[model samples]
Target chain A: MMKTVKIKKYSGELQDFDMNKLINSLRRSQADENLVQHVARNIVDQVEEGMTTKKIYQMAFNMLKSRSRISASKYNLKKSLMELGSTGFPFEKLVGKLMEFEGFNTQVGVIVQGDCVSHEIDVIAEKENNHYMIECKYHNSQGRFCNVKTPLYVQSRFVDVKQRWKSQVGHDTKLHRGGLYTNTRFTTDAIQYGTCVDLMLVSWDYPPQNSLKARIDKAGLYPLTALATLTKTEKRQLLDKGIVLCKEVYENPILLEQLGINESRQRKILDDSLKLCSAINTLI
Target chain B: MMKTVKIKKYSGELQDFDMNKLINSLRRSQADENLVQHVARNIVDQVEEGMTTKKIYQMAFNMLKSRSRISASKYNLKKSLMELGSTGFPFEKLVGKLMEFEGFNTQVGVIVQGDCVSHEIDVIAEKENNHYMIECKYHNSQGRFCNVKTPLYVQSRFVDVKQRWKSQVGHDTKLHRGGLYTNTRFTTDAIQYGTCVDLMLVSWDYPPQNSLKARIDKAGLYPLTALATLTKTEKRQLLDKGIVLCKEVYENPILLEQLGINESRQRKILDDSLKLCSAINTLI
Candidate 1:
């Protein structure tokens, strides 16, 4: 069936289902051409009026899962990121790691002196003549967009911190920028305010070219939680131990042994992580 | 037995027991002088190291509850204000009523045009030549202080709103200001930023001169949720109907009848409300 169907988004917004979007995501999972077509067709056939995008995603994920565990894990990246933590500290660490992978000296949580007061900045990244103070807004709950108030307060803090940074020696020539990164979406007003104030706004799908999802996919920085072989408990344990990247598991197979997994299971898990991260950039 | 005890506050901070503060609270409950002295003596005698201020308040409340429901209800004012709903609309309305009692023309939940965008102002009070844009931060959980981020964002919103307000005709000679009211305490940082930006901040125990608790008691504008006679459901029903003040019950006993409360009980409840609000200002 080639019929157009309305799909409800996490934000309760309704929009006509785009077949190309689903196909593109499935292809991004590294699924073969035949399997992608099969999954896309299955989703299109099962999709009905007022079905939530969540349900549609689940259907596609299940189809992909029955075929390839590696592809399924890749497809499950968003939900895996959501499992990071309620407080978003793990997510902050993930972001800091991403920046580190890109040759930036990054601090996950550091207390920075502002002009008026001190601020506990989530991530501070410094690279060649460029310094970024990033605030990571993580919501475990779906559809909780970072609103205008976030950027409003963040902008003020940025101004205060930037003022203090400017007063330091050797900072005069350095480019200091403020960034807001959230796992979920940013409201239009948040985007507007953040943009108006020249704050780098990055969310799941915002800013089109270099969104959080795009950056993660490009970097092959899938979180350890995204591994389908790992249980929730195992995922949480890995997260607790600061093993955020699937690439970390592949690099250190002994970490699985530390988790009390059998030698055979450790090999399987490590193999899966390696195959998933085979396309990862050579920086790490 | 009159030894000083290091009691823990709701914010997890340690503080020494002050008999005079407890005694003063009892006196404000409108309990007789003898009862206030007796309660103070009992609290002082029972005060133990590491006991929470919450526990101390509960002990005093139970002692007052047995002697006088009116006094207990009055003493329960802070907790009652907290029960004004989780979303805090009722608290906003109660604030609007308090402002109304003070003869200021007030609008709660007003949408005002800002310089760049629009803002949903919590409370806007105007009188004579003064206009105030107020934001109310209500927290159901105890010890959640309004942090510096509050004033930081509020100041930005206020600046945006004030700029738009100034553009209107006949506003040139009038004074525009910003106010922030919270049911909880404000962090020292919040107070500092607010003060620096000239934002009038009123919290439960802040300012010492004109705090939220003081204003509510002084105006005799106790929330209807403070009535010990009303059940949770009944209070919610009254709150839903926009009947926030205890004085509203005294002025109109029929509201109880609307809640399916019988005649005799309604009379008793009204009498209790009257006794609680008997010290109300003549202006109210």
Candidate 2:
């Protein structure tokens, strides 16, 4: 579903840059050199919905690009969730990581029907005839083991519902089998419940190359535009080695050699990345 | 739609109690008090999903209701939202309030045609035969509304792709209508775009109820079980006198009198609600 946005953004550019952008351009086209920048800031400040970069320029009264300051559009927006602390908790991102590494066959958010909600899981990986329900839970800490009972309660009931519903003569029955995946360990009672319900609790203890460490790095670099932000030399190196994120780029030196960056620029990217790492690290 | 949840809770009694009361009965029946309490806690924690009191007991120990805990099932659920903080930032309850407010209608998340994201508009209003998109930017001080440009920049754009489809004629064309709403004021350019495109922008002022208070309060109550928490004393006033909310109940005491709240209780209700000058005050 997220892919739909990218597809539409491309088509939108072909349609005359959208009316919202056109208006901003018109404003920028009219303003004078010094005033255009001043006006552009003010106009951007006054900007509201249905506004495009075109409308911003038009608002500044500069039809000529040279006449206006800050006349260009912001080409890319890499929402560094690390930099923007308020974005969101990384649970879903972690879920994506877990699924990608384990090769969960289904897309995220697809509800799997099973004997119980615990037996019911987030992503389903079915091949040939055998499949398992994975109940995934993400907890911030072990202290919240008490809270584990609630999710189990839900999963059990959901499994019951699925079983009852499937026993109905006309319903499909294979969908009623899956296991559980949780970030935290279950209590004695929870473990009992999982077993009774035939729920296999998969604890995420950072699975190896298939490990969480590598996947987190890979998921963070899913966007192409963000990779473009690296230095030009770094960019070519990453491209040559197909190293997009700090994780891969750091792990692979061949790519760096291919790009042939000077020691100072390499040091600069590291410094810049360190600052970013500090910011991002604080997010969760 | 939210109203449906409340009305749905009107079963298994409170015995006249409610779903909550019904579950409490199950808790009481357990031979082991500690286990019963732990089970009760699970019910309480997982209540957002509308787990019945019976199910809560079942989760603790299957078919335990044959014991004394049977009575716990009678707690009058009253309303689902009531169990999960009468007014909380949680999504389901927020959805209930948003859907119930006047001029706002939540479509089932689907390929519903609209010019914005599904949950983007905080509140919506109708004006001049168009649905005005609203983004209620709540703050400590009515959010110094110096500009709407950046705010408006975020308004969703719907790209018409029906004609591009192979089954172009088969695709639904009933999407060109519908406006967006926001809690912030629209800029001149935004308003111009709105007028040009038949979209309307409604700004919510800090004294939120200042402008839309009456509309929201009078919008009518949703039937979600969440409403049951108001106590019988509360429900009567809303239904009997057409008082939709506690604010409306306090604002117009004749309804409270009709609900049989003594003048003293009526005053107390009023005192508890004076700060909630608008439905948004209470709704948020």
What is residue A92's positional error in candidate 2, in angstroms? 4.2
Question: Lowest-lDDT window of 10 residues in candidate 1 chain B?
Answer: B275-284
TM-score top scorer: 1
In angstroms, the error of model 1 at B111 is 0.6
TM-score of each: 0.84, 0.24
Cα shift from native, residue A193, model 2 (Å): 1.3
- Model 2 residue A75 CA deviation (Å) reads 38
The residue ranges of model 1 lying beyond 4 angstroms of the native Cα positions read A1-21, A42-59, A62-69, A100-103, A127-129, A170-175, A260-284, B1-21, B41-59, B62-70, B100-103, B170-175, B228-234, B250-284
- For candidate 2, what is the lDDT? 0.38
Q: In angstroms, give how far residue A107 of model 2 lies from its true place.
A: 2.3
Report model 2's TM-score to 2 decimal places: 0.24
Model 1 agreement with the true structure over A2-103: per-residue lDDT tens digits: 888789997899999999999998987878899999999898888999999999999999999899988898888889888987778889988998788789
Report interface Cα RMSD per prediction. 1.4, 20.6
